[model samples]
Target chain A: MEWIRFFITAALLIMGMISFISAVIGVYRFGFVMNRMHAAGIGDTLGLLCVVSAMAVASGLNMDTLKLLFLIFFMWFTSPVSTHFLSQVEYYTNRERARFMTFRKGGEPRES
Target chain B: MNIDQAYHLLFMGALIIFAVLIGIMLIRAVIGPRITDRILSINMIGTMTICSIAILSGLLHEGYLTDVALIYAMLSFVAVLILAVMYIPAKSTRGQKQSRPEMADTAKEKKLQQSQSGETTRQKARKKGKKA
Candidate 1:
């Protein structure tokens, strides 16, 4: 039983690491900050979820596991909000945004 | 090997990989051309740090580290939020006209130059493709 649990935790941990690896690669390769945000989201949501769950599994059913679950919940809620703020900053600050992004309302590209 | 040894090896390997990933993100943060890119890279670094701390808590069998990881997550979130907020006021203060009209005019000139350069590049690529 101990061996089984160990293998399970190892597997989950490996999967989480793989997710983090890909997220880092995507962030490096993507052209724009907005595109990179998509990659970062993968690590924030899936990578953290897997790793924390593995920790919870390793620790077993305890108060720590409950805390880990809450950590995951909190991250899921906050990642999008932070990403939104970052993109808003990008949208307002980048002068070349008109080249990369399409405008919805004006039908013509306008520079700020 | 036994279960304990196996667990030790696994956690050790994971920690090493996390360290490498964090280092790569540090480079990204440093070389990032734009402020948003730098902030995004910093945000990613914070996340990986949280994961590493959580893994450390498990490997060292420290319960308090779990709480530390939780607190770090909250702090990281707030840091990114605050950094973003810091950049927002300059754009919002002028009611859409932009606070620095001169900068916008220069940006427009640069955009026109970039578009012209882009068109030339596209034409060159088309000619090269057609030749083949």
Candidate 2:
């Protein structure tokens, strides 16, 4: 039983780390800021989710697990808001956005 | 190896990986070209730190570290928010009026009328095309 629990935790932790590694790679390789933001969002949501769940699995049902789960909830709610603001700031400040983004018929900027 | 030793080894390895990843993120933050890129890198580093803290708590069997991780998460959120708020233009009417105090009332009225129309770039382009 102990070995089973250890394996589960290990697997989950590895999965989370893989997600983070991919996210980091994406952030590094992507050409545009908005594309990089997409990569960062992956880490904020999926990477954290998997890592916290792995910790919860390691610790079992306890107050610590409750706290960790609450952390995930907090991140989920706030990450999107932060991403939105970051994009808004980018939109307002980036004068050369035409080079990286395409405009729709309605004047909305979309990734080219 | 025994279960306890195996668990310790797993966590230690994970911690090492996290440390390396965090360091890479730090480099990215330092080299990020635009202000927003730097902010984004900082946000990523904050998240990886939180992950490290949570893993540490599990490895150490201390509940207090979870509390630290929670608080760190909150601080990270606030940091990103404040950084973003700094870049957003303070385009409030009062701010505009205060900045343009020398403008006559009629000019201000005309400006407000144009702003109220909410003209988009597509519309402006069409107007320009017609004028041309």
* lDDT of each residue in A1-112, candidate 2, tens digit only: 8778888999999999999999999999998899999999989999999999999999999899899999999999989999999987787677666556554433344211
Q: How do all models score by TM-score?
A: 0.82, 0.83
Deviation of model 1 at B118, angstroms: 21
**Regions of model 1 farther than 4 Å from truth:** A107-112, B90-132
Q: Per-residue lDDT for A25-111 in model 1, tens only?
A: 999999999899999999999999999999999999888999999999999999999999998888767777767765443222333
How good is the docking of model 2, as DockQ? 0.49
Assess candidate 2 and give its TM-score to the true structure: 0.83
Which residue pairs in model 1 clash with each other? none
lDDT of 1 at A55: 91
